[model samples]
Target: MNTEEKGLGSWTEREREELLELGHALFACPELGFQEVKSARILEDFFEKNGISFEKGLSVTGIKASIGKKGGYHIALVADMDALEVRDGENAYPFHSCGHSIQTAVMACVLKRLKERGIAEKTGGQVSFIAAPAEEFIDFETRAKLKEEGKIRYFSGKQDMISKGVFDDVDCVISMHINGDSGGPLFDINSTLAGFMVKKVIFRGKASHSGAAPHLGRNALHGASLAMDGIAYLKDQLPPEAGLKLHPVLTSCGGTVNVIPEQAVLETYIRANTLEYLLEAGEKFDRCVTHCGEALGIETEIINTTGYMPFAQSQEITEVVHRQMLELCREDQIVKNVVSGASGDIGDLGYLIPAVQFGFSGAEGRIHSAVFSVGDEENAYFRTARVAEKTVEAILSDPSLQVKNPDFQKKKEFYLREWLGENRE
Candidate 1:
């Protein structure tokens, strides 16, 4: 169908090609959180060529640009720039299994197309484009090192950017995530999502010869195993409605067969739908790990870190995006009130602004897995860009559009002090 018949905004054939080409380029060369040097350079080139003035390296390769009047209400469009550490569909090194490459390309295309079409100049508000890094909660060691160096204060990209005063002037925010399979619907509006906290557990014990003086050794591996068992038993107390999810992995165990293991490490994420339930479950979980270490006579240290907040979308924003989505897809192809147990740093943005993250179906396999890939490039690139672009246009045109601030959106320092033990380094 032609642009007039389709009811969605128009984009040139060249624009479509650029978006798809960029998407594929990003997919071919995936990088982990806070390490997206080449990925950031690609976007920087795009912005420079298109005359979008941007500041580079906000949180290690993050980019931001603004268009429209300075004093007007600001509308922000954000895209995560980092990819996953999972093996690709070919079972190679790192890949874009989480579809962040597509997401980033779509956001860039949306902003570029809007600028080319003169929508920002006509609108009364300022529009900002933020290419954020480290959305995925992986690479904890790298994030910790950055934190210790006083380079960053948080693990996730959005939180780090917020701390750096990136979104201070922004009012409304929009983001798109790639969902699994283009089967049931082309688009979905997120109704809600769970938030989580990170925990790193270390068990220390004395090491001794396994055969000669086994009685003198204190086995830390045994202590970690007992803690895992206790955590399994504690699952019985988890209420189903709280949407609690606790998955712990033993990252390090014994070193060799001849010596009793002196150190063991465990890492986990505690997720829940509400802060009250999350804290309740978190405290209980801490007790389980600590008591297990005490029972085994091993020293234990549990470090708590803040995670994304529970996602709550503005009803008005959802209504606006839903209307724009209907123009792109048929009524049957639109899904509403979708809830997921998964967590995202976008939820942290939602707490501060009237933010909404919608999903588009273009991939086939399970998310965050090796087999996940872009099954339909057309839907993933051009079509998805159309929806996002139109939504931004609609919101920018409305002068009365305003977001209601909620009480639960706490300051960034609260999280740093309460969870991360931060007080200006």
Candidate 2:
């Protein structure tokens, strides 16, 4: 894995080996959201070995390390530190199917290079490396419990971090994700991500004997079916450019065949390309569910939880990244202006600060699947890190590349008031 063979002369052989090893270590011991103890330790040990100091215990397992002066133009290099749950046969285990391990490794490499070369000091600015947890947005039961214990207020790591004042002083953010090889480009820039909200509806009805007195009982499952039908019909009215998505699953319907079920539970996420459409679609969805339940003589209870916001990448920062990508690869190997239906917590961060999460290809299988694996170490780890390092340098050195700074308090107040509602507080 020499620099001459891969054209990654910026990194020494020892540094390259260390970065790859770090990625492998994180990949080997995968952990779920908000429970990433081992993953956090791996990153902490790496920072310590590199003589970089960091603060831990954020959102339970998140770590924040910074360099250079404070109260200046600050930029963040964000990495998500969690894995997806993959089921094999009857068993399920945590796996790095989304290439988050690669993200953490690349950000760590960038931070190390910046510190070793004193780039931040020379530019008279600050750069923060944030190893954020719980980007997967799973394990709701655990998160609910954590909320009850006052350990966390938001389910997503970045959301909780924002609430805890982690991004208060940050001016902009730079993040990356690993994409499966499409036989097209090695890098993707200026991609748009969907915002989403979680909905849990419970339909309540009367129970009765199925064979003897079926007519006397109200059918909750029937009510849920009608609501689903209404949603399906409403889908036609939604705008295509909104990129809305609704996938509902019945978590509980009935117990036995002979008994009329007294309750039915349906949960899903409402996703859209922007916050305006997201809220509008959510109101329509709630009306559909409630009206369907009313028509069926069943009582419906809806609980809404705030999910990640939609991501509109900062063109300012994205242009810098694009230039960096071109320096490493041909124009054909770089993709721009991609719109994806995927959702991530980085969207929440982007609401307050200008953020860009570019995608890189070096994996062999579909992300979030059991078969996903690292196919090329050079493209995945070395080249990705080089681009990030160069982008940070460019942004820090050029003061004119600054992003608009929104009032943190006002933005957060609106986010909590409109999206999270009064119940979260």
Candidate 3:
């Protein structure tokens, strides 16, 4: 790709430097989910300096800045603003192992460039830059406390935004993530993602002295262990195409070693490729856990929470983006139609309107691991932003480009009622 042909010739050196500086600033202080105080402030300051007015505190820390008028074909460019907790030796700290800092920075750069070039004025359609919070599902304890205080109703940030009518005016969504696996290609388009449901189980039994009267007590820990074994055995029966993944962790199993465990808590996620298959696998999983605890003469209680819907990329939008990718990368350097088991809240937003999350290669090391770092800042931060900006311009310039827009309210109600069992008025 030559300089002019690369489509990056228009990007000024100052803009390029600003992109790297913003990425590095975000990477320096990685904050989790809704607690991204410093991270949010940095992006907010950037928006202020650029003269972009934004609404903050949507999902506690999520931000939205809109350009152009609201009535036309509205589009949103989403950037997740949360990081994972990585452990080093004996201590654990928040880090951008998932490269969300790159997403935030690139989107910020795209928004700034679009505003500077007055692209939105040409299209007469709105372009919104959304800094979404709590894409990562970890830190449940803190989230639960927030829930008790009525700060948030859903664990995922996108769900909360949906319930709060954040995307009510938005027509579609375009987002990107940094692909840690650089072996694939520079860009990946139209990849599918799995959806998952959060599961929590509790087993209760009578406590007794282990040394004196072990036989009189029903061990809850034994029940949990048996339930995990049952789940492991059921895995073989599940179809491979379903992509069933169940990995339960024992969060609590008694307090002392001398007494028989009277309570055990297990938490996991049931993930699958489609909604029907996800529910089917969830039913089987529940039965396995419930029966296993019953067999051990322990009382079992299970709680279910909606995680995310399966992500099916919009083919029409993807084709448009593919043309943009071909200009910056070789034909062979773009991967298409790959399926992945990883889940993201973007899937939830896809249920209401057309959404596509393209992947760009620039990072190395395993994602969600401590060693993950950006190896190619040019591709991760600069090139990816160019493709995103170009895609937006293409979509906005061609009013003929269209995708199926589902009934926003009906779908939102169905998601909240059928999937989440909540009937919000």
Quote each prediction's TM-score: 0.86, 0.93, 0.90
> Candidate 3, residue 2: CA error in Å?
4.2
Q: Name the candidate that leads on lDDT.
A: 2
Ranking by TM-score: 2, 3, 1
| Reference-based lDDT, residue 422, model 3 | 77
Instruction: Identify the superior model by TM-score, candidate 1 or candidate 2.
Output: 2
**Model 3, range 219-247, lDDT digits (tens) per residue?**
99999999989989988877898788889
Tens digits of lDDT, candidate 1, 233-331: 877787887788888999988679999999999999988887677888889989999999999799999977788777878788888888877777787
- What lDDT does each candidate get? 0.82, 0.89, 0.88
Error of 3 at 62 (Å): 1.0
Candidate 2 ranges with C-alpha deviation above 4 Å: 1-9, 209-216, 255-260, 422-425
TM-score for candidate 2, residues paired by index: 0.93
Ranking by lDDT: 2, 3, 1
| Separate clash counts for every candidate | 0, 0, 0
| Pairs with steric clashes in candidate 3 | none
